[model samples]
Target: MSTRHILLGLLAMGPRHGYDLKHRHDERFPQARPLAFGQVYTTLQRLVRDGLAEVEETGSDGGPERTMYRSTDAGARELADWAGSVTPSAPFVANEIFAKVVVAILSGGDPAAYLAAQRASHMQRMRELTAVKSAKDADLTTVLSADYALTHLNADLRWMTTTADRLATLTAEVEST
Candidate 1:
């Protein structure tokens, strides 16, 4: 994920301190891995250094002083370009699961057993994500994120099933290599 671009986009909304940005990022992308505090500060600093953002203000209200950041005009332009651009879809399938399967076959390990375990794990995650998406209080953002994850997991599950069905052929090919 483009952490820098995301921070720039967030700053484009309004001035925000690191703490606020981090929390807002979490709220906006609940399915994403949570941003670390240090990561936020580091990314913010980089944005400032790159002239994509600047410190709008610094003040304290009976607490540690907070530096509020805002996106620069350049940052706004960059965010617009990034938002408008389309992400490439499956340009290459560099699948770790495929690699592991090949390795297991080559090493005389049980690829079928590994695939079974992986399928179980994927099913469990899909169940959890489904629950999150179907929760009574789930917001649009949360539901959308869960849906995105579920879609990917579903694809992975299909791939695993296909791979399992061809395991014997795959093993023969790997062994020949």
Candidate 2:
């Protein structure tokens, strides 16, 4: 995730203080890990330094003063380009689970048992996500995010099942190597 690009996009909407930006980011991306307050301020400072954003105003209603930031013309262009770009799809499969399975077989460990435990873990997470998606009060964003996660989890479950079925062949191949 490009924090810079995301902040730029938010600034494009209008001038915003770090607090407002952080809150809005959380509201908009509920499934994402929440942005830390310090992270938000740090990223905003970097954006201003890079000329992608600038301080539009500084004021206070009654409390401490706040610096409001707005996206610059350059920032707008950058945000547009980033939004238009396509993310690479599975350029490499650097799967930790697969690596662990191979290592277990080489070490004379039980790859089958590891796969079984992993499958159970994955299933539990899937159920949790399903409940979130099925909630009556769930918004479109929550449902969509849950669906995305569930799809990936389902794929992983299928892969684990296939790998478990082929463990005998895999073990023999590893021993031969």
Candidate 3:
């Protein structure tokens, strides 16, 4: 999901500092898949540049106050528009990871090693996707996209497991002089 709507949503709630926004986003989106602070600030800057959000000084922090962001009327309107927009159906594109695995197998690189690394990565991804799926506040639009992506990861992990086992069996059978 693009950060545009996320920023707007944050501002829609009330004025918030950059850190506050990031924290709230993490709380909502889950830290396992948290948006980076750089990403949140960059999007916030873009929102300010777009006139969708404005930085305001807090009147009473009782110390050095930080810049807080509030959504403009236009921002609220934009958020509503975004919320009403239809979810577009898109085709999944091929990823380089699978290509790398195929190349490794064809090039006589040890399939066990390749699959070992791939399984580790895929298992981590699966955990993250599972966390996202279970999160209550996760936007379904984003969640469904993640779900589709995880389906591909699951398929690859299955292939890697099977291939690793088969290759290990074959490697064992070959007499090493």
Best by TM-score: 2
**Candidate 2 steric clashes:** 0
lDDT of each candidate versus the true structure: 0.91, 0.91, 0.80
Model 3: lDDT of residue 122: 88
**Candidate 1 lDDT over residue span 1-177, tens digit each:** 999998888887899999999999998988689999999999999999999999999999879999999999999999999999999987678789989988997898998999999999999999998998899999999888888889988898898898888986866898999
Alpha carbon lDDT of residue 78, candidate 2? 86
Give me the candidate number with maximum lDDT.
2
Q: What residue pairs are clashing in model 3?
A: none
lDDT of 3 at 152: 80
**lDDT tens digits, residues 55-161, model 2?**
99999889999999999998899899999999989867878898998899889898899999999999999999999999999999899999999998999899899
* Model 3 vs. true fold: TM: 0.56
Give all TM-scores, in the order shown: 0.82, 0.87, 0.56
* lDDT ranking of the models: 2, 1, 3
lDDT by residue (2-75, candidate 3, tens digit) is 67798789878889988888888776665337878788878988998999999876554787656788999999
Higher-lDDT candidate among 1 and 3?
A: 1
Off by over 4 Å in 1: 168-177
Worst 10 residues of 3 by lDDT: 26-35
